[model samples]
Target chain A: MNAYIDVSWPSLLIAASLLIANLVLSAVLRLGMGRRLLVAGTRMVVQLVLLGLVLEWVFDSANGPAVLVLGLLMGVVAGVTAVRRTSIRFPAAYLDSVVVIVTTAFLVTGVSVLGILRPTPLWDPQYVIPLLGMLLGNALTGISLGLDRFLTGVLRDRTRVEGFLALGATRWEAARDEVREALRVGLIPTVNSMLVMGIVSLPGMMTGQILAGAAPGDAVRYQIMIVFMIAATVSTATFGVTMLAYGRIFTSDHRLRSAGALGIELD
Target chain B: MAPPVDQAPILTAENIGCRLDNGWIWRELDVNLAAGDRAVLTGPSGTGKSLLLRTLCGLDCPDEGRVHHRGHPVLDQDRPRFRARVMYVQQQPVLIPGTVQENLELPLRFDINAGRITGDGTAAALLSRLGKSVEFLGQRASVLSGGEGQIVGLVRALLLEPEVLLLDEPTAHLDAEATECVEKVVLEWVDAGDRAVLWTSHDQAQVQRVRRGPSIDLGSAS
Candidate 1:
């Protein structure tokens, strides 16, 4: 009835031929990616199917609490993933990640849905859940890069930092450079994406919307909103996590805490 | 120049003990550095001479004792003030990115030194004493030789005018000329009165040249 076409099972089977082509190429090149490719492809299909079913029920129920709970669960997963992506391991790192990711994702999504999108009867699963997922995913990446750079910078240039401390600098003064650099490193990815969003690539939201038969102009506007939201959330998360992390790294005595306190070994 | 034994000690370590993963590096150590004192610390490698200096400057806490400055026990809250008064210069000095003048001006920018900014004339005078012209201040720090960088670091510490200077082989990387320049500047600094120094050196000749008071041999200590 509508311009959007349904992706039936028959069409999906036809698409499966692409995987055979990939497997044949991997085998010929002896890339050792044959098994990995198959496993990953299978996992993607299974996970997406599962998510589709869960999302169906969620949308049908139209429950605000259910949507919020699901968003929070995604945030927690994102938090754990962010910490694991960084080499700096600390006892309270996961807690730091969780706080930063959850707060930024919630605030950005809340503002977008309630203030900008104004999806009727706020907390509408259709809008809230997807926006939350996108924000959480991007925020997790930014916070991870920030944390990694901050910790590694401190570790590498410890002598320079201590030199400042020895000259009577406060903890904040000693760490100012590292903190600024970390924030910059975190924001680079989102900034680069914004620079070439439409020309270099059609973003996921816009592409999906167009495939669903939405007007190009409307889809572009939504994509622009999503990018702006992501940039704000990522920067906010990076700044928040860097501030919390520096406190834990330096003690009240203005000395660098031992690696043991961070639950990691310094090589 | 012997210290005034009658005056209060500028710094004191009470039964100070330090340990490493291997075992006790030093134990039950006691020393008093009085005004105008120039004490030399000597030991073989691994005796933790630098570590001892770090502890005295409040950079490292001893496992079993405390350090005091002018009869006041050094605490966590008082560390910034304590470090300001008792400065420690490592063997290899670290310089932040900037010109020599900027490096010298850094300590003055600290909150503790807010009201005590060193005048440009003082920096010039200090640089002159170290065989550097006032124009040397404009030279980029990254381009300076190791010896020149060490001089900049020394001038920086001198501008702060700390009460006690814990020198960790400050001239280790310097040529004889540079070494003499450092010694000349430091000697003039201590001549001003009420200042003290504890320097570590393996060169007996340099020690004899610089030592105005007693030398403590940490290598022989238990």
Candidate 2:
């Protein structure tokens, strides 16, 4: 603090080295990864720089409405990005659905922290922003994975599904296996992480809490609460996305015309 | 040649064409099968014979063509319905990963209404038709031989009671005796007044047996 030394020089040097290594290794591998690497590195630098500036404004804003607006915008952008990764078509309603689900889930979780557990100043960037980011991040991942697995199941097992239709299964019945597979895929990582927690190593949340001078017992309790909340939010978001996706698989003729829907094919 | 329009042909292919990458496989191909008609399709290697049969089954789409089952298009949203009415058997049949009974019931898992036909009687009848005992139901799909798997696939399709049946090299891997058995059962199925059969073969003699209908030979185009 006494010496206003620049720490960004080390980070810049590491970033430059990474770019050079990526170019050289991509050429050696002959896989054409160099372009993607360059673009990603450049984008990351520009994005982070811009975000750092923007976040300064966010932190300085004393208005609660401004903070809430920023949070809502962040959740909507995150949800849209996650949906785009599935390469599936969605109705305009889907965006609204994602917005409502993600914002509500994340905010509820955030508010629980405000009133009951960690009594802090309202709209505190230190607590609310980081927690909102974490919850939204997990929810986004769960939604994408759930949508992908469900769509894949529908595409790859079209014959099995049609075979079900022949056997007199309704639309929902035909899609039951796909839904089950998607839900299992979404839930498995959370289940596995829960099983491995504390046995293999300390989780990141617990470590961060401890590092911030909280008691170990308190940190563990907060970590447990976060895990449970994340699991619940993920399940709810996954179910919502999938149910909406199913409606898109059918046509006006009441048949499963899923060939072009979501860019997914029934086998 | 076209069949009568009002008769509701079990399967029809109109102006079918197939091409992949830079190669042209077949063009403007047409065929029709009414109830109880038996047809054999023969061609040399890479003549698009399998592609044509696959197109009939709604598995492969032609570059420019239309397929109809009972006078209904079998493409896009209509495919699931057509697939229910017509079953396609591949050369090396795909067995859904499960026990034999589970594989048989896989189609039922999709359509709950089809679950009604999943009782003991249907399983027994299908097994007997293929000269298999009901005990084969509990066997694992992974443990079956090539012929056994094909038989199971056929029996599974038969349980659906499809109106039209399409086969690709049905006897390619079967022994002489097994081949004869499959032919007999399939011929019997085709003889039923409400059903039809279209099959592919490389053996000239096999194509000649049980002369019930016409044979479309892919000439020079190979």
Candidate 3:
């Protein structure tokens, strides 16, 4: 009785008109993005279609390890994207990024799937994969913002931080302000989104659920949980990445490493 | 008067060299500071006077040589305590965004300086020596003039009762009266017989007034 209407392949082909419209607009405006737009649309279609097939196989097999491996693969991809988002460079950045994203995603998704949602067959591909994707994606954005801000802040306030060091401050004391500011910058986006949730816009997860014929109240509850999970994931990931990255900026002797370490001037 | 030459040097820099992005600032530089000694670091512009002072305070590491505090190499474990005793004041001192008193009290909040907090009258006394009133401590730090900010920085360093003070052009922006006030307070601090001062000043008069001992010319070393 709760079955939902599904779009057939013929109906889906009709959706291609939107991309045609965009391509025509790019042509009329003489925008250089025409080729890029075409490439992007093609890639999206190919990737999503492939993902649909993969998910169908995954859901049918319901293999716990396979689902877990897929989630980790998604995290690694997100982690690489996150590192490219920041201009600052340090030792082991890719490893640090992956550690933060994967750890936070696992923690949040694990808690939601096993403890809160408690779906049958705990590693159920349907529940675990989507939740991990959502958590990892948001965590990547938060951590990249934090890493960029903190590194830039250190470069900007090198003198002030050195002043603290000269005054006998521990390394943590020297960088505490910059770290706090970076974490705040990372959290602000999620905090602002939470503030405007539902009233201004329907979030992706909620809208998806509603389109699948879920009741409005059920969709809203899922949206609320997802937002909280996102906020938690962002906080943890940002903190973890920022703290881990500080080791590369400051030497073991507690002195600020040379500008070469950050590939920028601190003077 | 300089402390007796027999007193052991409180700090020493041997064959020290520092290189910035461009080139070598100085090399094979040697210096010694004994208790109650007044040493002036004189050099031409761009001769690394500030960089040398930073090295002395362990804020920077020398590329080629070692710095010893009381005969022990200043290692990572020793830096916190070493910097506590050897304070370096920048030419343009930085203050946190707060009241003057808050800025002065900032160091005491650190773990190393915990329980070493100055009493109510301590900052007031240091300010009075600089001809600043007790009420001056309440003024916003950001609004203070350059001379006033430098004076607050001096008081903050002085409050810590450091064994050696490495002052890098501390009076570059002060008026004659304020400079004189700073000079007098520094002289009184060195008069304690167990402390040392290494100051850099472009002003010949101020340099002559402060150095009771030999002046180290960094320009020659470069």
Candidate 4:
């Protein structure tokens, strides 16, 4: 395969042109979303441009400390976003989400880097950044969904939870069903996307690689590996977040802190 | 009446209060359930009858005062042990998903109540007393009617043989006959052992029929 030809700035005009159809449709229909769409589109462009600049710098330097700092930053943002995605609130929920998300994302990223895709020391940044970014992004969705379902389910089943507690159930036993359901709900997206990988739609990483002149077979291998890693990261992070959040919401005295005193804040 | 108040009162609460983010539900309420004592906890809606029951069984932390189970403050006792003895059965009990037998036997699965589990014979005997047939054990718990759920809840608590039952309107949804079956089971259970019960009921007749001790009335919200 020929070395990938770089698309210049003028070529981006063609990409930007795609937005005109949405703008025209929204305006012609007098839909109020046109302005919001314009604002969102502009912000997305600005964010991606900034990301491109940052990634270029990191790719050039490949400094160990700098790469780690960036990885931590991504994880933190992902963690915060996960918490923000949930409609429920409790005092320590944010801290729990961040802790679980960052720990799991870094754990999976490290394994994929040093263990599976053993790129040489210099290529570490290239492998670590994307790998961590993808894992963190997926972890954000999974953990957030898990957190949302878990707290919601507990609140919904407050009476049942208390009933179990009243019947000599430990906090873990009372909450076991809710946690299991939360994990299942959080993992569905990753599982479904994997289910339809090559047939329904080409995965983003593989498409990008193929576009950049990598062989189809190599791109498919990377995509397949990523699919496995994503599944792992999502399930582990989701399980961690829900269980940690469960511990936060239920008191040590076999009480659910969801209904009356020390109640969970529902936003 | 109330078996002579002879044995450290199976459960005791002095000036215990229930507070939420909004405000206090009840304040400075006191209750005592001695061996063989049967008392009805009464209050208008929102007066915290349910909250008081929860507070007594160690399911809720009182914003004020403390709960004592068998002479030990709730904090000092092992929680599962404390709760095992003073189980709080809800008005609409939440049955774990599965057969009614699963819900009834759930406490046995907990280490605190393990090894004491009897066979289905005892469970069926108790359920039959509550008007549930033997085959009722196999019915999916999720499909039990509100009244049926309350029966299962009581039977489940009985299977654990809790020393005291903090029943929060356990028969509120039952018809006359079902309610009688529940009262019979509860009264028989209390009469047979060291058990005590603090029950809340909307039915005035139930209060008169069940109480052997002076009733506790948390006066209507001011």
Can you give the TM-score per candidate against the true fold? 0.88, 0.69, 0.87, 0.88
lDDT of 3 by residue, B28-144 (tens): 988888777899998988888998999888877899988887776777966877888999988777799999989988887667777775666988988998889988989999899
Best by lDDT: 3
lDDT of 3 by residue, A210-237 (tens): 8898998998988888898999999999
Of 1 and 4, the candidate ahead on lDDT is 1
Pairs that clash in candidate 1 = none
lDDT of 2 by residue, A1-267 (tens): 123335575688876997798699888999798888889988988987887776788788746676677677778877886677774444543574466456556666666676556744567665666667767777777777888788767766666664454433456777887988778887777778889999997989888777767788998988887788778877877777777777676443234544643444333
Off by over 4 Å in 4: A26-40, A116-124, A259-263, B1-6, B21-24, B75-77, B96-103, B106-109, B115-128, B131-144, B220-222
Report the alpha-carbon TM-score of model 3 versus the true structure. 0.87
Decide which is better by lDDT, 3 or 4: 3
DockQ, cand. 3: 0.58
lDDT, candidate 2, equals 0.71
Looking at model 2 chain A, report the run of 10 residues with the lowest lDDT sum: A1-10
lDDT of 4 by residue, B1-222 (tens): 323434578888888777766888888777888888999988888888887887787777888998876666766338877888888888888777899888778787677888776784998888777777999989998788998988888887887878988898988898999889889989988999988888898878899999998588876533
Q: Clashes in each model (backbone N, CA, C under 3 Å)?
A: 0, 10, 0, 0
Question: Residue pairs in steric clash, candidate 3?
Answer: none
What overall lDDT goes with each candidate model? 0.85, 0.71, 0.86, 0.83
lDDT tens digits, residue span A128-148, model 1 = 989988898898889889999
**TM-score, candidate number 1:** 0.88
TM-score of only chain B in every candidate structure:
0.93, 0.89, 0.94, 0.92
The per-model DockQ list reads: 0.57, 0.17, 0.58, 0.59
